[model samples]
Target: MSFDDFYHAHFRGLVVQLRAYTGDVAQAQDLVQEAFCRVFARWDQVSRYDDPLAWTRRVAWNLAHNRWRRLRTARAWLLRQREAHVAGPGPDRVALEAALAVLPARQRRAVILHYLADLSIAEIAAQEQVAEGTVKSWLHRARAALAAALRDTTEEAQDA
Candidate 1:
């Protein structure tokens, strides 16, 4: 079967399978698309396989598994950071809140969405109706501003 025919026939089923595996439709769709790209790149040899669709599914599953692993690693690192911060003298909550309040609305929103809501950059971009790069820029500026404000607050407290 031609690649186009195979893709049309199997795309939906692959997405469904990946969704079941990943438990997130967006991630499943991404994995399936990535698998398709890989297959398309090597279609000459891939088509010779007895079960090209099976090959595609295997690649998609592997991609999903790798994504899961990376997410787990990230979560663990975040947890470690949280623990380390908790063990130390953290910034004053009142000062942190004040710093956040002083930020521009867009910067505050971007920070809250990414850190508090644990949203991905792509998710934040979609929700904010802005490009991912815009979201990133907002986050960068917000972090810098917050850090400077917090540092000033710390120095004031030390002087007092």
Candidate 2:
């Protein structure tokens, strides 16, 4: 088959497969287009192969994988750079930390475990060597104290 005929026959199917694999239509189209360009460059030999479509499909998939790997590396580098540029915690976090400090030690530990650390009540109970009910009570009381403290801070700011 002519290169033009071969491309027309397989381009959409290849694009669809690449799109499903890559989750990006534009990227899929570009990969498929580049794959066809490569195949056309060597069509004299490729057209004689047992399965030109398979060869084209494999080329497109390889292009997609290479692109994904490059993007993943770039994203990791960006995230590391972003970590360095991150700003310090703001006033609300400061106020919340101060409010947390005023909680009794056990209550503070329980609150930090259950909420900040995302531990379950039963897990906190096991960690703290206390009953689940005690952890629950500490969480309830700590939440109330934090609410009251933050509210007071907000009120003081308004008054000032």
Candidate 3:
């Protein structure tokens, strides 16, 4: 398919998929656009791939994770300044986001892919270019970390 047709057909699905990682529609849209731009920039190469959609999704997923990492570094600096804290009660979203932000990037990606995107471990392994066993290990560690991180919040409350 042509790039225009391909983009029009798959962009929204990619955006919705990215939303799970970002938990924000606007950010998801941005991630999708970035992914498309990457693919377009390398169209000669991308078009030769057997599954360009998978490549696009993986690109979006990776970008979202990178953005999350950058945010975490910035937030960590902000958090270190006890006096610079945003005063007053913040949204519960802050706590949830902070917890997620602290997870190791690979573990977070595994959890987001397995639970948030409802992908199987094998699928996650393929997207991440890791072994299935590694994906399982990541998932196990992620579950433990998330449980420890969000000890008080109801797990049921955080579904996107």
Q: What does the lDDT come to for candidate 1? A: 0.93
Give the clashing pairs for model 3. Answer: none
Rank by TM-score (best first):
1, 2, 3
In angstroms, how far off is 73's CA in candidate 2? 0.7
Q: Per-residue lDDT tens digits of candidate 2, residues 41-81?
A: 98999899999998989898999999999999999988877
What is the total number of backbone clashes in candidate 1?
0
Model 1 weakest 10-residue run by lDDT: 82-91
Q: Over 4 Å off in model 3, which ranges?
A: 84-160
Over 27-135, each residue of candidate 3 has an lDDT whose tens digit, in order, gives 9999999999999998888988999999998998999999999999999987887685567656576766777788999998888888789999889989999899999
Model 1 lDDT per residue over 1-160, tens place: 8889988999899999999988989889999999999999999999999999999999999999999999999999988777444454455877888999999999999999999999999999999999999999999999999999999999999999
User: What TM-score does candidate 1 reach?
Assistant: 0.54
- Kindly give the number of clashing pairs for every candidate: 0, 0, 0
Better of 1 and 3 by lDDT: 1
- Candidate 2 backbone collisions, by pair: none
Per-model TM-score on C-alpha atoms: 0.54, 0.53, 0.52
